[model samples]
Target chain A: MAMVEIRDARKVFDGGFEALRGASLDIEEGEILALLGPNGAGKTTLISAICGITQPTSGTIAVGGHDVVKDYRAARNLVGLVPQEVNLEPFEKVWKTVRFSRGLFGRKPDDALLERILRKLSLWEKRGATIKSLSGGMKRRVLIAKALAHDPRVLFLDEPTAGVDVELRRDMWDTVAELKREGVTIILTTHYIEEAEALADRVAVINRGQILLVEDKDALMARMGRKTLRIELDEPVAEIPAGLSDYGLRLEDDGRVLVYDYDTSAERTGIARLMGALAAEGIVVRDVATSQNSLEDIFVGLVHDGQEEEGVA
Target chain B: MNWAAVAAIYRFEMSRFFRTLLQSFISPVISTSLYFVVFGGAIGSRIDQVEGVSYGAFIVPGLVMLTVIMQAISNASFGIYFPKFIGTIYELLSAPINFLEIVMGYVGAAATKALFIGVVILVTSSFFVDLTIQHPLAMVAFLLLTCVSFALLGFIIGIWAGNFEQLQLVPLLVVTPLVFLGGSFYSIEMLPEVWQTITLFNPVLYLISGFRWAFFGLSDVPVGWSLAAIALFTSLCLTAIWWIFRTGWRIRS
Candidate 1:
């Protein structure tokens, strides 16, 4: 069963800009769901709606059986949000900032538990230092520490590694993995396809205020992914040959490479027949290589398709 | 009523307050003392007394009221503005606490800071000239009420403001002028009859008059009327804040 449910949630900002247009999805308990989208694709808006920062223009959201609008206190208590920005109180000490966050949720003070989280994030040594004195990466870690201070059942990280260095991004991924191993339900939004491919159990694609699709990570790759066979010709052709048109072969690399896009799931790939046809057409193939479409390519394709649809409208 | 949340926010604000401890305490003390040297010394040597009290003693309540109002508004405005500027307000909004608790945390801390500054100014005033209290409880009440009301007004300004210019606009343009012209340094009676009536229309007059009456047992307006004016102002500020939160104006969208 889904742990959090959003029913056609729509978030329209002021000036009639619709950030989320009937966007909906359910997050499973203890699973990491990565929401992938381009800029202005409503990724952060959807998270903000779930976290109760940005209220939905219409529809409803429930977390742990509590409605976000009617029963916000209960719903908010069940979720922790590490927002897109590292916005810690500059003058506040690290431990105190976390303690205050825990207390803001009406929790009793637990220094020992907080200390453990600090150590896990590697922020233990800087616990006494003011937030302004910490480095950018450490400050991001502090944001995560504060988010987990109250031990929220569900956590939302909006672009957790938007501007972080590669090393810090890797560390953040490890920390997220550790949290998932410990039974925390994590939902994060990112435009980085590689991160989503690496971290998420389920991936949802959103574009232009709509969720295009949501599916298991590996399942989605295998289902939508296709391989392209590129044949490097020893000679260049100015135009497509009439004989090879039936095989869906296109000349690329300025007519020096013959490209054939074929699905891996086909009962018979027909590569041999296509080669024979190409040879019959007197197109000498010097070399051949097959490359699978990556998640990155799929993301660009989906976003491009969405824009084209909008342009037509 | 999430008391823990209120306390948490309040403590964090106070921590920020103390982070600039030397500046907060010393600036008020030093500035108020300058009022003694310039206004009290230079002006008092010419016209020594007003309303049967020495010139130095006469402006004590006015100076304290001026500082308290300004400090409360500035501290409160900056308190809420910084969080919004840095985007940490989303954390507070997403927390399990309601809007009222958030207001209490911020306004309460701002009021407390103003109150502390008021006490410090009062102590500094005592060193320059003698002061007597006719109604100690009323004086304390006026001091606290002004702190809270002005802080609430400042909270409103902080929410309504979109930039630094708007943040300092009202405190600099409207509030300080009202306090200074409303009879902070000189008594309303010192002006001509027409000007005295015009000055009575200034809302700040009632606050300073009531506060002065607490110290000297004399006022330009009846003490009851002054109390009524402030009570009305406090409720008006409260009503404005309550409406702002209900509508989620500026703070929510």
Candidate 2:
């Protein structure tokens, strides 16, 4: 069975806003799944339903083969959640805060385990300090330590690096990688495309309370990812020549560079034919380079496509 | 039963109570002592006794009931309210524990805190007056029942309230006035015939009268009626709490 299974879950708030509209997904054990979406795209709502913070209006969610609503205790016991907000008791000590989470999950007091987690998150020295006294990054670390205190089988990190600094964000990525290596099933939601690109085995895109696509990160990139070929010219051109007009190339950098976008999966890229046409026109090419599109481009394109579909609907 | 989770919440709340020692422990003691000085000292000299007991001693149970009710309500309300206000309640909601365990932890701690304050006030009252407990067990029972019942009421209020002002609305505007009008400082027998019947309708009167009977073997209402009144009040509070949890009324959304 999958580690986490969500089957056609729906959430309609009291104000008649449908936050989640029949979203379904299955996350395997020992792999990281990154949920990417725009704001209010139901990424957090879907996480909330799985974590039992909010009940779904319809359908079901199960964690570790136990239904989240029917068998909430067992389901909740196996899952840990790190919410996006930094909501800790201001006067609470870091050690007590982490220890309390373990106890809340019906776990016995394990000081050794607690120590290991705090140390792993670099929170050992600050364990004695109050939450309010710590820096923002340290407080975020405390949240991670709390989530790991019970040694849960699956973990959910909702926008974990939303406001974190560059150095701390890198540290968080390392922590998540280490957690995955330890065989924990991790689900993360992020607006930062690079973070998802770096950490996820599979990527799920959500927009407007619906799952747009769920596929292997590499496969998604290979299937839909486009490549750009940049041709740097030895001499500037006022306009595209009559012979090169059929190639649909864009003149950039004050006409010093001609850019062509092509699909990698296409059988004929037309790059060679374009080169011949340039040569027939007697254009000298100083240098040539090809670059693949980053995940950001694909993400933006997907969301934009979703928006256009909504507009058409 | 998720006892570890219960204990975790209980200890966390108790630690906060202890952390604010001056406000939680000392302030109530000092305030109760002042009430004794004003009602028991200044007024006791003018009025010799009520129902053959010294005026100072007669008001002891009433004063303790007053403090216990307020403490129970405020402690439990604040215990739950602060978490909701600060948004730490998400952890509790997402935990493996059920609502029963959540209530046991919060209400148990609130009752314990109120009981402690009640005992302290009783001891402090003895220093100012010649005091004796005719039935110590009954006194303890009354005190315990009052703490638990009022704490349950506070828990409901905490869940119902949307802001700090609404949180304090009940304990201040409703409960405090009822306690005072319920004859906490004087017996209903001293009131006119019509008003005595009116006082009999006040729920807090039964608690105070039963508690006074425990102290001095004297009560404005029959001992059986007092016990019955408290039993009904406790059951009502429990029912309200059960409904709140069942419907996920205010705590879950």
Each model's backbone clash number: 0, 0
For candidate 1, write residues A1-313 as lDDT tens digits. Answer: 5779988998778798989899889999999999998888898888888888878889889998899989999999989999888998787889899999999998889999999999999999999999999989999999999999999999999898989999999999999999999989999888788999999999989988888989998888887789899999899999879988877878788989889999877777889999998889998889999998889888888788888888942
Q: How does model 1 do on interface RMSD, in angstroms?
A: 1.0
lDDT of 1 at A281: 91
Best by DockQ: 2
lDDT of 1 at A274: 92
Score chain A of each prediction against the true chain A by TM-score and list the results. Answer: 0.90, 0.97
Clashes of 1: 0
Report each candidate's C-alpha RMSD, comma-separated, in the order given: 2.7, 1.3
- Tens digit of lDDT per residue, candidate 2, span A58-129? 998999999999999999999999999998999999999999999999999999999999989998998899
Using TM-score as the measure, which candidate wins?
2
lDDT of 2 at B7: 98
In candidate 1 chain A, where is summed lDDT lowest over 10 consecutive residues? Answer: A304-313
